[model samples]
Target chain A: MSYLQLSLYSETLRLETNVQVILAADPAASPCLLLLHGASDNDTIWARWTSIERYANRYGISVVMPGAHLSAFADMRRGPAYETFLMRELPEFLHRHLGLPTARELNLIAGLSMGGYGALRLGLRHPERFSAIGCFSSGNLLVATGFIPGTSDPYGWISLVMGEDINNPALAGNPDFDLFEILAALHADAPLPRVYMACGRDDFLLNCSRMTAERLAAHPALPFYYEESHGAHDWNFWDRYVKHFLDWYTDTEKTLTETTTD
Target chain B: MANIIFHSLSPALHTQRRLRVILPDSRRNDTNLPWLLLLHGAGADGSRWLRMTRAEYYAEAKGIALVLPDGDNGYYTDMRHGYKYYTYLSEDVEADVLRNFPSLSRDPQRRYVAGFEIGGFGALKYALDFPDHFRAAGSFAGGLDPQSLDPDYCVLTFGSYKQAWQAENDLFNRLRTALTDDTRLPDLYISRREQDYLYTVPDRDFASDNAMTSGHTIKVSRFDFNSADPWSFADRSLAWFLDRICPDRAQLFTPPAAADCPDDCHTDCSDDSLADCPTGKPTKE
Candidate 1:
C-alpha cells in the first residue's frame, strides 16, 4: 500500500485541511473506500491503530481517510461546510488527481463513532454516489432530547449544526442532517443504498445503534444488515468489525451481481 | 497526518513566508521524533512531495516529521537577483518548524534534509552551509553543478555564471572546502538516474571526490529507468535518510519473513514433528 498525506485547500470550506490516503499496490481500476475517523481524531488513526494498509493491499482497494475534526459531517452553522466538502469537493479532488472511481458500484463509505454517523448520513443522502455504507458504534443519531442539557442553554453544540428549530421542514426533509425525520418519511420508491451497521453490545453508543437499527427496520424496503457482538466501542472492536464489514461488502456485492444476472 | 502552515519573517528574503509541515501521527510518542526538511523542486510548492510520492507512509513508518517549505523556483539558493531561499530554508523554516513542533528533536543528529531535482541541490547546499544543524543530507537527481545548468537560470539564481561557479554558490567548490576543513561534516547520500542529463556526471564526480577525501563519507547509488516510467527516487532517498539517522528504525522496510518459515517452523529440524514439512518432505527423524 502507498500512503499519501495531502494538504488540500477546500474552496467550499475556504481553509486548508489534511487528508491521508492509502492507495493499493495497483490503484488503477481498484474500487475506492472512504474511511472516516471519529471526533478529535485525524486521518492517521486508521494507519496508526489498525492494519488498514495490509487490508487494503489484500483486498486491492484504495482507502481515502480525511479528518473532519469535531464536525459531525454537517454543514455547521458556525463552522465549515464539512458535508459539502466530503460529498462534493473531496470526491472531485480524488477523481481528478488520484483517479478514484466515480461509479457507485466502485465506491464504499464506512466510519466509526462520529464518523459512522457521517458515513450513514452521507451515504443515505447521496445514494447515487455510494453502493454500500457501514457504520460502527455510531453517535449523533436520534438523541432523546434535541440538545445535551447541562448548562443553562438547552440547545448547545448540536444546535450549532442542526439549528435552533429542530422541527423545521427543511431540516426534517434532509436525511443527511435529520435521520429521525427522514426515517419517518421513508417510502417504497426512495432510493436506498445497501447498509451495514455494527456495534458492540457494551458500547456506550449501543442504544444509538439500536435506535438506528430499529428505525431502519421500520422500513422494509430499505436493505440493511445489523449485527452486535461482545465488545466495546474501542479500536479492538472497530478493527475486527471493519475487516468483517469489508468482507461482508465484497460478498454482498458478489451476491447482488449473481442475483441480478439470474 | 497533521498539516500546518505558519508565517515566517525571513531576514534573508526580506518578506514574510509560509512554511508547510506534514507531521507524523501523534500516537507514535516514542520520543522527540526525528525530522526531515524536504525541499520541493522548481514549479512546485511544499505539498508536492505528498502529492507525488508515498512519502507520508515512509515518514510514518520511520517516525519522522516532514517539513516541506516552498522553495519558489529559486533553486533553493541565496539568489543574487531574486530571493535568498537557502537562508529561508536553513534559518526561517527550520526555526518555525522546531518552535511549532516542540516534540520534534532539536539535536542536530536527529535532523536531516533531502530534495529532488533542484530541491536535491538545495538539500546538499543546506547540509554544507549549515553543518551544525543537519546530521545528513540526500539528493535525488539533483542539479549538483549550477554552472552546468542553463545560462539564464544560473544568471537569475546566482546573478551570473561566474558567481554560480564560485565557492559560495557552487556545490563542487563547497564540497571541496568541507573536505579540507576540520569542522564536523554531514554525511551525504546522492542517487541519480543514469539517463538524467543534469546530474549523472556531476554526481559521479562528487562521489569520486568524496571517496578520495580522507574523513568525509559520501554514498552514491545509481539507477536506470525510462523517463516515462521513472523509479520512485523519493522512497529510496527517504530510506537512505532513515538508515543514516536511525538504523533500528530502518528495519521497518525489511521484507517479511519467508512464507515457508512460519513463526513456529523450526530451522533445526531435530524433532520428528517439526522435521516433516508441510509439503510431506522427510527430515531428521
Candidate 2:
C-alpha cells in the first residue's frame, strides 16, 4: 500500500485538517473506500488497531480515512461544518488532489461507532454518489423520534452531537439528521448501494445496529447483511468484523481468516 | 505555499521516511509546475533546508514544487554496509510524490535536483546517471574532490577515503564519461564562495573547469557568491537555482543581497576544517 499522510486546508471547515490515504497497488483501478473513525479516534486510528494496510493490499482496495474530530461526522448546529466537508468538499478534494475516480460505481463508505452513523448518513443520503454502506456498532440511535436511544443517562453525552434539543431535534420531518430516518427515507428507482450492518452481541450499543438493520431490511428495496457474535464494544470486535464487512462488500466467499485472527 | 509532510514505509531503504513537499499555492490547477528535488547534507535531517534557509518561500515565489528528502550521513548513496538511500530517493521518492500529487509535471525539462554538501554530490550523480530524467542539477560548496572531505565521514560512509566510491562519486570523471559517451548531459550549476575552504582552496577550480565544458550553450552555469560563510551556501545556492530555473518569477531567494551585509558577516567561515566561529556556533552543513 502507498500510504500518504495529507494535511490540506478545508474551505468548508474553515481550517486545516489531516487525512490519511492508503492506496492499493493501482489507485486508478481500485475502488475508493471512505473509512471513518469513532469520536475518540482520529484518521490514524484504524490502522493502529487493525491490519488495515495489509487488508487493503490483500483485498486490492484503496482506503481514505479523514479526521472528523468529535463532530459525529455531522455538521453540528454549533460546531465546524464537517457534514459539508465530508459530503461536498471531501470527494472533490480527493478527486482533484489524488486523481481518485469520482464515479459512483468506484466509491464506497464504512465506519465504526460515530463513523458508522456517518457511513449510514453519508452513504444512505446519496445513493447517486455511494454504492455500498457498512455500519459497525452505531450508538445511541433508537429511532427518528428520539435519536438519543438509551434506557438511562449513561449515553447522555451523545446529545452533544445535536446542540440543543438533544432529546428530540424534530428530526422526523428532516429524515436526514438521524440514522433510522435516513435508512427509512432512502428512495431510489434502482437499488444501488448494498447495506451491511454488524455489531458485537456483548456490545452496549448492539440495539442501535439491530434496530437500524431491522428498519433497513423492512425497506423492501434494500439488501440487508447483518451479523453478531461474542465480543464487546472494543477494537477487537471491529478489527475482526471490518474484514468480514470487506468480504461481503467485495462479494467474496466468506473466508475463515476471522476465526484464525480472533 | 503549502508544506506537506509525507510519511511512508519505503521498501527500497527498508525504513520509515518522512519526506516534505512544498507545493505552490497559486496556479495549482495548472498541474504542470516545475519540480525541484532538494537533498539535505550530512549532519542534518530533511529540515536543514527549511530551518537554515527560506527555500520553501523561494519555491513558492518561483512557482516550483520543492521536494525535500533526508539524505542521511551516508551521503545519499546505496552504502556498502548501510541503507540504499540513493535508490529510495531517486526511485521511490519520485513514485511516492507523483502518487500523492499526480498533477506535478513529468517532463524532463521541468525536473531538476540540487544539494549543499554530500547532497550536492548526490545531485551530481543523479543528473549524470539519469540525464533523461532530470534537465538540470546544482552543487553548492560540495562535490569538489571528495578527498577534501572529512576522513572519518568518508571512511564511515564509503569503506576508504582514497579508493572506495572514488570512481562512482567523482563528478569530474563522470562528466568526462558523459561528454565522451555523448549522454546528453543535464545543465549544471556549480558554485562556491571565494573565501570558502572545502571547494575554492582545493587544487580544483570547479567553476572555471565547468565553464570550459559548457561555454557554447551555457549549460554549466556558475555563480559563486562573495560571502565567506560556508553556512550561507545553501541559501545562496537555493536562490540561484530557483532564479536560474524560473527567471520569469520574482526572485525571492535573496534578501537585500550578500553585498549589502556587513563586511565581516561571513569572515570567520574561512577555517580549513569545520569549527566554531569567534562570533557564532559551528556550521552544520
Candidate 3:
C-alpha cells in the first residue's frame, strides 16, 4: 500500500503534471485501479478523504489517481488534452515507467461525482483497456439543458467541453458528450467492460445513476450491476460504495478481452 | 523542482520502505544527470530532510537530483538481529527508483551517497561496500567508529561492543578493504559541526590509506553552525558535498562563510552563550 506522488512531464499537455500512484506489494503481479477524484478536488483527495490505501491493501490491487481538473475527462473543445493524457499517455507512462500491468483484464477504472462520469466515459469509450468500471453518483451528461446543482457549470460544464458542435468530436477517437450516444455507438455484441453503478438515495445525481441503470437494463447483453443505497453526493456514501464496488469487482472475474498494450 | 515520494515492498526486509526524490526541472530533460542518495539519522525518516532543510531549493539551482531514503534505526545496514535493510536498499529500492525515473544516470560516476549522523555512517559504508555504485560519499557528524557510539545503539544494532561485529562494521576497516582498489572507489567528503565530536581526526591507518589512494579526491571541513536547527549546518554540508562531487553545482549558492561573522565565537547556541555572537546565534552556514 505504498504510494508515490510523482510530478512528471506530460508530453500531451506540454507541461509538467502530478499523479499520485499507489501500488500493492508485488505490483508486477497485482491488478491496477485507475481511481479518479471529484470535480472539487485534485489527485490527493481520494487518499486524503478516505482509507483508500487500507482498502486497496486488503484487496491487493494497485491504484493510480490523476487530477482531471474541471474537464469531464474528455478532449475538451475549449480545454487541454485530458482524454489523451488519461486514456492513453497515463497508462503508457505507468506501464513504461513504473512497470505496472496494462492488460485489459488486469485493470479497473472507477470514480465519484464528476470523476464517476470520467470513469464511466473512459471505461466505456475504451473497454479494451479495462476489465471493470466502478462509478458512484455519476454526473449525468445525459442532460439536454439546465443545471446539475453540484457542479460549477449549470448545463454541465460539459457543454463548455463539447463546445458549440456537441456532436463534433473534439479530438480524434473521442466520443460525443452524450453517454447514450457513446453507448449507442458501441456494438452490443462487442466485448463490454463489467460495469457497476451505485448512488445514494438522497444524492442530487441520483437521477444520473438511475438513468444510466435503466439504459443498461435495456441492454441485457451488457454486464451491468446497479444499486441504490441509503446515502448522497458525499464522501461517506462514496467511502462505503467504493469498498462495495471493489468487493463486487474482486468477487466476480471477467473473461479476458481483446489485447492492447503500449 | 519536483518532490517525488514513493513506497515499495522490500523483499530483502519483507516490509515497505519510503523514499523521497528531489529532481531539478532543468535536469528533468537530461537522461544522464547526476544523482545523490542522502540517508537520514536513526530516529528520523526520509521526510526529515525536507522538514529540516531547503534541500529542494538547492537541488533546483544546482541541476542535480537528490534521493533520500528512510534507513530507520538500522543504520542502513543488514542488521544482525533485525531486517536485511542493506539488501533491501541495494537490490530492491535502487532498481525501483531507476525504473520510476528513467532520466537518472545509471553510470556509477554520476551517482552519490551522503548522510546525517548515523546516516553519515551509512553513507560511507555504502560507498565503501559498493564502490562501483557511487561517485562520492559525504558524512556530517558521522558515527564513524561504532565502538565509540552509544552502548545501547551498539547492542541493539550489533548485539555487543568490541566484538567481531563491531570490527566488521568499522568504517576504518571498510576504508581499507573497499578503498584498496584505486580504479573502483568513490571520493570522500567528511564534515562535522566543530562542537560536535562525532568525527574526530581519522586514525593513523585511515590517514595513511587516504594519502596512498592518490587516484581519488578526499576532503575534510568543519563548519561552526547550529546543529539543533540542522539545516543551519546541513545546508552548508550539502554545498561542500557538491563542492567535491560536482564543483560546478557547488557554485550555485554560496552561503555566508566564516568571514561573514566577525565575532564567530558562539559554538554552543544559547541565550547567555549567544552574548559572544554578533547575530545572536551560531553563524549561518
Candidate 4:
C-alpha cells in the first residue's frame, strides 16, 4: 500500500487543507473510494481506527480521505466552504494528479456519523458523480431545526451547522440541504446513485438511519439497501459495516483473499 | 505549509507511521525554529491538528514547526495490551522528526507538546514522562484520569483497571509523584469547557493540587461554552502557548496570509479536461 499525504490549497475553502490518499499497490487500474470523516474528525480517523488500508489493498481500490473538520461537510455558515471543496475540488485533484477515474462507475463515497450525512448529501445533490453512496449512522434525514425542550435556545446544535436560516421556508424545503426534500425532488426517470444505509441498533442515530431508509425506499426506481446490526454509534460499528458495505459495492471475485491474515 | 511524510519500520509500534508536518512557509531555511508536537485525540491521526484547527495558520508566523503523528487510538500510551504509542511519541517519532526536519530546533526548551482530549492526556503524560525533553505541555479538555475512562476502552488500553495498571498509567498518580520534584518538569497548561462532562472534576483537582504545590508551574484556564467547542479551545490554547512559550513576540502576531485564490480557482474550472490541471489554472497551450 502507498499512502500519500497531500497538502492542497483549496480554492473553495480558501485554505491549505490535508487529504490522506491510500493507493493499492499497483493501483494503475484500481477504482477510488472517497472516504469522508465525521464532525471534529479529519482524514486520519479512517486510517487510524479502521482497516481501511488493508481493505483498499485487498479490493485493489484507492481511498481519498479529506479533512472537513466541523464544517459538517457543509459549506459552513461561519467557516470553510467544505461542500464545494469536497464535492468539486478534491475529486478534480485526485483525477488530475493521481490518474484516478472521474467517471461514476469507478468512483464511490462512504462515511460514518456526520460524514455519513455528507456522503448522502453530496451523492444525492450530484447524483451523476458517484456509482454508489454508503451511509453509516447518518443523521441527515432527521429534522433538527426546532428548539430542544431543555436547551436554553430552541435551535440547539443543528443551528450551528445548518445556520438559523434552517427555519426559513425556502431553505427549509430546499432539496439540496434536506434529504427528504432531495428525495421528493428526484425525477422518477433520473438515474440515481445506488444507496446503502446501516446503523447500529444501539446507535442514537438509528432512527435517523431508519427514516432515511424509509424515504429512499419510497422511490421505487432507486436502488437502495438497508441493514441493522448489533452495535453502537462508535468506530467498532463503522469498522465492521464499512467492510461489509465495501464488499457489497465491489466485485465479489476480487474480494480479499481468505488466506490473508490480520 | 503542510508536508505529509511517512516513517517506515517504526520500532516502537512495529508499523509504518504517517505524520503531517506543518512548517512556517517563510522559515524553510532556518534550522532553529521552535517546534510543537501536536497530538490528536481518540480515533484521530496526525492530520487532525492541520485539518481540524487553524493550527498551521497560527504556527506559520510564530515560526514553529508543528509535528502531528498517528496515535492509533492508543491513548498515547505504551498500552499494556495494545500498541506502544508512548514510546513512539517520545522516542521514535521525536527522533524521526528531528532527523527529517533539520530546521526544527533540537533544544528541549524550544520544543513543546499539546493535544486535545485523549491527545491532551498524551501530551500531559509525555511531558511528565520525559520532563527533560519538552519545555511546556498543554492539554485542551484532556482525559487526565485513565480510571475515569470508559471501562471497555480502559481495559483495552491498560489490560485491566487493576491497581497495577492504575499505578503504571494513571496521570494523577504520576502527577502526585512528579509534583514533589519539580525540577526538569514542563510547565503545564490545562483548559476545559465549563460544561465538559468528563474532565471537569479531574481538571479541578489537578488545578487545586498544582496551586498547593510550592513553586508551581501549572496554569489552568477555563472557558464557557455550551457542550465543547474545539475551535474556542484551539484559539485559547494558541494564545496561551504564545504567551508562555514566546511572549511579546512581534512575529507571532502577524495575521495569516490572504487566501491565494489562484491556487483555488482550478477546483471549479468548467472544462472537464482541465479538471486535472496541476497548476491550479487552465492549461494555456
Candidate 5:
C-alpha cells in the first residue's frame, strides 16, 4: 500500500488542513475508506493502530486521515468549514489528485473519539455520500441534551450547528441532531449503511454508547453494532477497536462485492 | 411511465436522508399500484437503488412502485438515547411516502419489502417480525441475525456482544423459530456471494438450509461476485429478484452478466501493475 501526506487549503474554513492519506494502489483501484481525525488531533492519530495497514491491504481500500483540531469536529466560530471541507472539498481533492472513484464504493467515513462524532455527524447529515460509518469512543453529541447544562433541546448538536437556541421548541428538538432518532426515522423510509461503534467498558463514554445502542435495538432496519471491552479511552482500546471495525469493514466490502469487472 | 418518484426528505439536516416512492406517476395517477419498500445495506443510503441500480427505471417499466428509505449508520433501529428511527422508517416514513406519492395497491400482496447487506437482514427481520406486512421479501448478503451474526463482526456492529445480543436476541430467536417452523415467514429470497466475509458460513448455511426447511419459500442464490461491493451486487440481484417475485416489476429485469470484468475487488494492492485492475487503468479523460 502506498501512503501520501498531503495538505490542502480549506476554502470553507479559510485555513489549511493536513491529512495523511493511504492508497491501496493507483487510482485504477476502487475507492475505499476515508479516515477523519478526532478533536485536538490530526490525521496521524490513526497511524498508531495496526488495523490501518491491515484494512488498507486486506480490503484493497485507501484511507484518508484528516487532522483537525478539537471542538468535537465542530469548526467552532472559525466557520462551519470542517464539515464543508470534509463533505465537499476533500472528495474533490482526492478525485482530482489521486483519481479516486465517486459514487457507490467511493468512500466510507470513520473515526475515533472526536473523529467518531464527526463520522456519525457526517453520515447522518449526508447519508448519500458514505457507504458505511464507524465511530469509536466518542460522545453522542446529538443526544447529549440533558447531559449538557440548561438545554431542553432534543437535537443538541443540531441546534448548535443551525445556531438555534436550545429553548426554541418549533425546530429546536427537531430530530436532526439526534442521530439515533434519525436512524429510527430513516429506517422507516430507507435502509441505512452498516454502523460500527465501540468503547471500553470502563470508558467514560460507555454510557453514551449504550444509550445509542439501546435506541438502535428497536429498529429492525438499522443494524447498529456495538461492543464493550475491558479498556479505557486511551489508544490501546482504540487500536483494538479500530482493528475490529476494519475487519468488519473488509467483511462488508467483501460481502458487497457482488460483481467484479474483468 | 415512472411508477415511483424520488424525493429528498430531511433536507434541513446536514445529511441527505432521501426517500424513494413507488407511486402512480403523473401519467398513471388515475391507476392504483402496489408499493414495495426497499432498504439498502450498510455504507449506503436510499439513493443506492435509485442512482446506482436505476431501480426507479425498473419501477417505471413495471407497475410496482418501489420506495427506498435512507437510514444513516443508525442501522435502521430506534436509538436507545432518544432517536425514534424504528418509528420513523416503518411508520412516519411510510406515512410520508403514502401522502407524498400516489397511492399504490393496499393489498398485502402489493406490499413487499427487501434490502441488501444490513438492509437485507433488516428486510428479513422486518418481514418475519411482522409476518403479515409483506407478501414477498428479499435480502442479499444481509447480516440476518445480529445475535447469530459472527461474534467478531457483531461486536463491531453494536460495540459489544452483550449489547448486540441484548438488543437483537428477540429477533434472532424469532428467526430461529421461523427457520424451524413450516410457516410464519414471507416468500423469501436470501442470497450471498461466494467470497463474502461478513455473512459467513453460518449465516449462509442458516439462510439456505434452516431458513428454507422451516417452510418459507426461501431461495438462496450464491453468486460468483465480490461481497464487498454492495452496489454491483445490489444492481444485479435486486433487479433480478424484484422482477421475478414481484412480477409486477417485470420491466426492471434487464439481463446482467459478469463478464470480461477487470479485477475490481481490492482497493489496496501489493502488485504495482495497472493490468491487475478489472476495469484497466482509469482513463485521464
Candidate 6:
C-alpha cells in the first residue's frame, strides 16, 4: 500500500491544486482500476471500506484513487475546469510519482453518489478511452432537483464552469442544462459505452435511480447490465453493492470464453 | 537521445483541442522507442496526465515517450457536426508520433494507449476497435454500458431512448461479447474505489462479470482511495502493469530528474545521497 500526494501547476486550470492518490501495485495483475470520488468527500473515504483490502488480495488487482472534492470535475469558464484537471492534469502527477503502466486496458473508473453521476456522464461522454465502468447510488440528473442554486447551478461554486448565463438558454452553462437531453442525443447518434449501476431500495434517491433505470429500459438498442438490491443510500449499502459489481465484472470474462467456443 | 519534442496545439488545434508530446531524453534518441498515447476524459486536455502524475518525467526516464491529445467533450470519439477527434487521436496522432518522435516503436508491443475518466473510454475504445494498434491498454474510471445500467444518467445526458438509441446500439452486447471473447483482446486492467460515488453496482458488475465469465485478461482493484485523487492508485497500478508488458523501456523505471538541481549541484553539494542534491534537499537558504 503506497500513497502519493502531488501539487502541480495545471495548464488547464491555470492554478496550482493538490491531488491525492493511493495504489496497490500488483505485478501479476493486468488492468488497474482508477477510481474517482464523489463531490464533498476526499480520497480517504474509499480507503475506509474494508472491501477494498479484500478485493485487492482476492483479485490480485491494483487501485488508483484521485481526489475531487466539492468541485464537480467540470470544465468551466470561472476556474480551471476540474474535469480537465482530473482527467489530464492529475494523471500527469500520478505517472511521475507512481510507477504505473501507460496503456489502454490498464485503466478503469468507478464512483458513488455524485461521483457515480460523474462516472456515468464521463464514461459515456468518452467511450473510446474506458472499456467499462461502475456507478453506485448515483443521482439521476433528469429529475427536477438535478440542478439547484448551489449544487450544480453556475452561480454557485460551479459558476466558473458554466460561465455567465448564455442568452440562447439552449446553450446555458448550467451543468445540468438537460444532461438527460444530451444523453438522449448521444444515444441516438453514437455508440454509447457499456454501463452498469446498482441502487438500494430504501435509499432516498431510489426514485432517481428508478427513473434512470426506466429511461434506459425504453431503449432496446442499448445493452446495459443492471441490478437493484434492498438497501439504502448509505455507504454500507454502496459498499456491498460495489463489491458485488466487482465480482460480476470478474466473472464477465467467462462470456468471452463461451463466445469463442460457441 | 530520448527526447520529448512538444508541439503546442496550434491556435486551431488549441481552440479546437490541446495536444502535447513527451519524447525520450536525448540519451535514448536512437531507433524509434515505444510510444504511449494517453487520452484524457471529459473536460481534460493532453497535459492532464502531466498535471495529475509525473507521467512525462517517468516516460522520459522510462524510455517510453508519450503523446497526450485533447479529447474535449468528445469522449475521444468523433462527435456530431464534424468533430474529427476519433480520427485525430487514432490516425492523425499516430501519424505525428511516427514522423516526429523516435520514441514510437514500430512494433505494436511497444505501443500502448490509456486514459482516465472519459479518456479511459478513449483508450479502451481505441485499443478494442483497433486491436492491431497497441498490444496492451488501460482505462481509469472509464464508462462501460450506461443505457441499461444507469438509466437516470442515460436520460439526463442523452435525453430519451429515441435519441440515445443510435449511440448505444449494440454497445453493451458487443462489449459483453467482446470481453468474453479473448481471441482479439488486449491485456486489460480495470480499477475502482470500493466506496466509489460513480459506476455503482451495475458498471462494476458488467466489467467484473466479463472478466469472470469471458476469460479476458482483465484485472480489477478496489483501492482504499476515491476516484478524485486516484494519482497514487493509478501510478502504482499502471506502473506495475507497464513493467510487466513493456519491460524493455528503461525510462519507466527511472524517476523524474530534479528540476531545482543545477548542473554542479550534483558535484558541488556535500550531500552524496541522491535525495541530498541542492534541489532535492529541504533548505531554508
Candidate 4: chain B TM-score equals 0.78
**Over all chains combined, what TM-score does candidate 4 have?**
0.50
For candidate 3, write residues A29-55 as lDDT tens digits.
899999988764667778877778877
Better of 1 and 6 by lDDT: 1
Candidate 6 error regions (>4 Å)? A1-262, B1-17, B80-82, B145-172, B196-215, B247-285
Q: Summarize candidate 6's per-residue lDDT along B231-272 as a digit string, tens digits.
A: 665554456455545566652422334454565654443212
Docking class of 5: incorrect
Model 3, residue A243: what's the lDDT? 83
In angstroms and one decimal each, the interface RMSD of every candidate reads 16.1, 18.0, 20.0, 14.4, 13.3, 13.5
Candidate 6's residue-wise lDDT over A1-262, tens digit each?
5555555556766443445454565432345566656554555556654356456445555666655534445664433467776666666655655655445456566788767767766665655556567778874543634544434342233333344333322332334434455456564555555567888877766777777767665665555677888877777776676566666667654221111110
Listed models, DockQ each: 0.01, 0.02, 0.02, 0.02, 0.02, 0.01
TM-scores, one per candidate: 0.47, 0.48, 0.49, 0.50, 0.47, 0.42
Which candidate leads in lDDT? 3
Error of 6 at B237 (Å): 3.8
Which pairs of residues collide in model 2?
A131-A193
Angstrom error at residue A52, model 2: 0.8
Kindly list the per-residue Cα lDDT of model 3 for residues B148-242, writing each as its tens digit: 66675565467677652465477776676555565567787877676754434545235354544556656556667564676567767776676
- Computed on alpha carbons, the lDDT of every model, listed in order, comes to 0.70, 0.70, 0.71, 0.71, 0.61, 0.57
Q: Which regions in candidate 5 have their CA more than 4 angstroms from the true location?
A: A1-153, A156-262, B1-17, B22-30, B80-83, B145-159, B167-172, B197-204, B208-214, B227-229, B248-285
- Candidate 4 lDDT over A1-262, as tens digits, reads 7999787656676455678999866555677888988754676778988888888877778899987655567775444567888878888887777877888787888899878988988888878888899999885644542222233322122443454433443334644577888777777776788999999999878777887788888788889989998888888888878888888887375454443222
How high a TM-score does candidate 5 get?
0.47
lDDT of 6 at B143: 55
By TM-score, who's the top model here? Answer: 4
How many clashes show up in model 2?
Answer: 1
In candidate 2, stretches whose alpha carbon ends up further than 4 angstroms from where it belongs are: A139-160, A166-174, A254-262, B1-285
Candidate 2 residue-wise lDDT, B14-125, digit = tens: 4446688888997678688788898876656577688678887788788888888865555777754345678887888988978887767889999998888778888888
